[model samples]
Target: MMESTSLYLSPTIFFPNYQNMLNSFKIYMYTPPNPLSFSSPTESLFFSSLRTSPFVTQNPEEAHLFFVPFSSNLSTRSIARFVRDLKLDFPYWNRTLGADHFYASCAGLGYESDRSLVELKKNSVQISCFPAPEGKFVPHKDITLPPLERVTHASHAPGNRTARYLGFARYNGVKESNLLNELRNDSDFLIESQPSDGMTLVGRLGSSGFCLFEYGADISGIGEALRFGCVPVVITDRPMQDLPLIDVIRWQKIAVFVGSSGGVKEVKRALDRTCKDDECEGLRRLGVAASQHFVWNEMPQPYDSFHMLMYQLWLRRHSIRYARREFV
Candidate 1:
């Protein structure tokens, strides 16, 4: 484990009104999970990260950010009801209009059709796995979370690699994509929509020189590929925002991006152009370097998913000037 570095928060930016807010940065977790409902692995990991962090405080008065850990998998009405109750109990929501609050979800699909929830979400920060389509995800306010997947074994070292070309385990959203058909027809391409088991998927990614990610904003596959030192080939129709930790990680050095409009020929050209042994090795090393940023640790570590999420919040918090408001 790498030693955690001391994080410096500028007093001027972090606490414009309150001088004590700099080193005393605090986060208050609202609404504990029900034993019956249970949190997903990602959600569980996030909560675990918060529990281990030194910044979490039981007192809401000292908090810099209020975390609503409600699962987005629930109905929008359920989430809205929770938010309504929160507002009734605390003055924080009304004061900032939800700007200082945040919630995490695997995807923002639940609140899309709900007008009330949509309006509320626009004011709050949404940390999500898949970037919502237009009118849904506000890039500057919301965060794109890297999908968290556990790696049981250390990735194999780069050497005389046997795997060649690109591969994919699933093809749900991109079935109609011409690139999918093109890669399938090409004799040199190795693509799989279904693997025999989890290990088989890992094996395919581990051996493959490049892994195909066809769906837009899906980082789960990208996470797995990076873990195994396989370079990711992202093919998307939508605008790809900077992958998580864009401020620190150079994604272009580790992955290939191909526009979906370019069709199969373009994708094939990219694969043919970049899958050379030397290029693959360089991508492998860069991927290894960037992989640490995506990991979710039981204890909050430097640049781990937890700290990265906090860092995103830190950036947003520094940008906004919070006025000193007295709450009774």
Candidate 2:
């Protein structure tokens, strides 16, 4: 776990504003009737964090934002039901039509039921693991959250740059990528057809200069590769896939991005070009630093995954609405 006092861990630009966010931003968390709604391990941690967070306000009138405690697997019907209950039981939902409300969803915004919840989905911001622009996500309005897995491995410092493999890539699910197939012959790349059920690739990942992780429903691989200091080479057509802290991080400095249109040769070419560059070392060094954001701690750190997500929420702080007339 990263210590909150580490001045050197976070990116230089994260400061001042990071401090500002902690100082002024206030979020009011609604106690949903279903306390069991926060399902995942990460979601449970986040919910617990909010309960003890200094940012949480007892008074909704003073809050800059509101939180829906449920995590992922949220359907429009379920959310609609929850909001309907809120509208009936409280004044906040009806006041601004939930414009200031938000919730986290690990399952991307592609749920068919999402379309059915017209009034609520339109106004409420979704901090989703999957942010497909074609789906429910409204660009800049919603945030792309990387799956926040609890990392137990000690943080490895980036030092020597003597990785044996040029790159590493894998074929996920049933269909093998044409790009991966071409690279299997290349000794420089460790291309595997096996499913990533475990961290079998971690050993190779430590020695690889770049990890070309194709974006899929299972996005955990991206974070796993990043944890070991491998520069992530994300291949995806989705506009904002595999991105967190999109507004702040200069991700181009830390990873290689090849579009879905790019072939294995193109991927190899990009890796080859990056491998030769002097900046590649810097990117590798930054990859170690950037990986810190994917980690979660029992105690929240300064710019850890928790703080970073909070910062994103702070950036997307919607219009403040104090509905209760007497309180206003």
Candidate 3:
């Protein structure tokens, strides 16, 4: 429902170089999702590397999309709290996750699948992001952002801070080899094997086998590594997990389980039990199966031709999906 304040368009609209123009597309980011908190940098760097194709529109109303502010869930007074604690900011955000606001403009097209876009029993889209062409943002090569420095110390130590698990939320049990080497070099801690390259699972073992809670993937992955599997020797909180594909799997089963407050000895003991148990193998197999859901090539970006098609489809329906553009 928010309106745009800018009446002018950028010169990129008329530029001959499609890539330059696409990169110049002015996007109004409302609340940026925390790159440190997310499972991987895919969401953060994905858009920055986008290069618009010839088919994509350049107008602010068409090319520029506004991310819904992460403020809808909190009170106006708590806006600062949400922004500070969650590391989110909605300086010029135009859309929200609300279906009503995006039904007409195609602004919310990438959001979770709904009746307005498609008919699905349950909301198929959990998270929404920009779409782009392949090789638009190559990991390690084009990724230039500095590592997050805020999550260095836990309130409690599990004996080692050098080792970690990586994965997006829910999709668990993946680890990278480089991470293990980083942790092994640390003299302060004993070496532990990291999981395969992905998110590790964490959960409570009960009569039903595993009762997983809604914890972040990063936390769960580390717990899983310490508690059960070790695909790596050292642990570093590196960008490991990408956005997940399937929705059925519980994150706890694949993640490494850890307590919020516990001594290193306790963590060691739990790891001993998990490493020696037969259940861990079954969990590992499940994790391998679950991993098939994510295909890195499928992520969206600003350059992909598919994005343009989706926009045109939405436009035909005659909807108000976007807000006007502004630079500041």
Candidate 4:
């Protein structure tokens, strides 16, 4: 698909102010906003990444995918107006019923606020961080984006490896409180329940062999762990539905998966089997390799998050065939 890959972004949605809206988060955070804490950087990263891809085309006729790059903060009425105008001005939306079109949003709360937006969800690829099953997130059609943090190659620090087995930072979810209590009592693990700064959290993740990933929270922690070469021990009841880059990364090869029930026992078993010197080294290698897929570069790189998202759209495009329409 890369040979002839092309995308046309709707001009109405890709306005000058749209870029300013995406970059606005940087004005307040000083640094890139943590993908784990807020949606702003995630939105901005995806926008900037796509903007630099070679596949982006000004001529709509050569395009395979049509992007509607709208922010989550846009009013539902404004979104509706854009769609209405696109349908009137361009034949692409009507020709494909928006199946060839897609949009990304990081604000889960904003999407849930407007019911009228459901029509858009039904038709286009809704790339989002929250892939809640009940929220009209069709797993087969939609894409789950990884919460990306701005990291240079030097972000990960080397130390004497003072920390041990596993670390759970800032975990206060009531549903998993029992498991947290169990792990806290165990001497093998480090559990931090209180709020902490970003550097502290990154240091904790870097030092530990494994990091706990709680379900229903920002899965960007998983990305952070991967970045630091820490194996992620996922705690979830269901299968990992929202894992980013699932299309490219074989998650089981690099990370541990455990059920919510018998959480301590499961985590302990995973750690015992995988945290040995040889096995830990292998997982670390895999994590470092997989980390390349999660990063966003100013210019699209091979196997980076931008190209991976494009690859996802390419896969979706091949799933169904559309008859070519001759424009009069």
Output the number of the TM-score-best candidate: 2
- Itemize residue pairs with steric clashes in candidate 2: none
Whole-structure CA lDDT of model 4: 0.63
Off by over 4 Å in 4: 1-39, 108-119, 130-134, 150-163, 172-176, 193-199, 275-277, 319-328
Q: Assess each prediction's global lDDT (C-alpha) against the native.
A: 0.66, 0.69, 0.29, 0.63
Worst 10 residues of 2 by lDDT: 1-10
| Rank ordering of all candidates by TM-score, starting from the highest | 2, 1, 4, 3
- Residue pairs clashing in model 1 are none
Q: lDDT score, residue 321, model 2? A: 56
Alpha-carbon runs more than 4 Å astray in model 3: 1-41, 44-97, 100-247, 275-277, 298-328
Residue-by-residue lDDT tens digits, candidate 2, 1-328: 3323232334454687789899999988887756455445666777777778899999988888888765455555676677767778777776776777887765544444432255446667777653233465666667766566433553564356468988887665567767667677789888775535444555667778888877663455566667677788887765553367776676777788777666777776777788775767777776777777777777888878788889978877765453543321
Residue lDDT tens for model 3, 21-122 = 434434333333332222334333323323233333434355344322332233323433433332233222224222111111101222222222221101
Distance from true position, residue 165, model 3, in Å? Answer: 14
Clash number for each model: 0, 0, 48, 0
Q: For candidate 3, what is the lDDT?
A: 0.29
TM-score of every candidate relative to the true structure: 0.76, 0.82, 0.29, 0.74
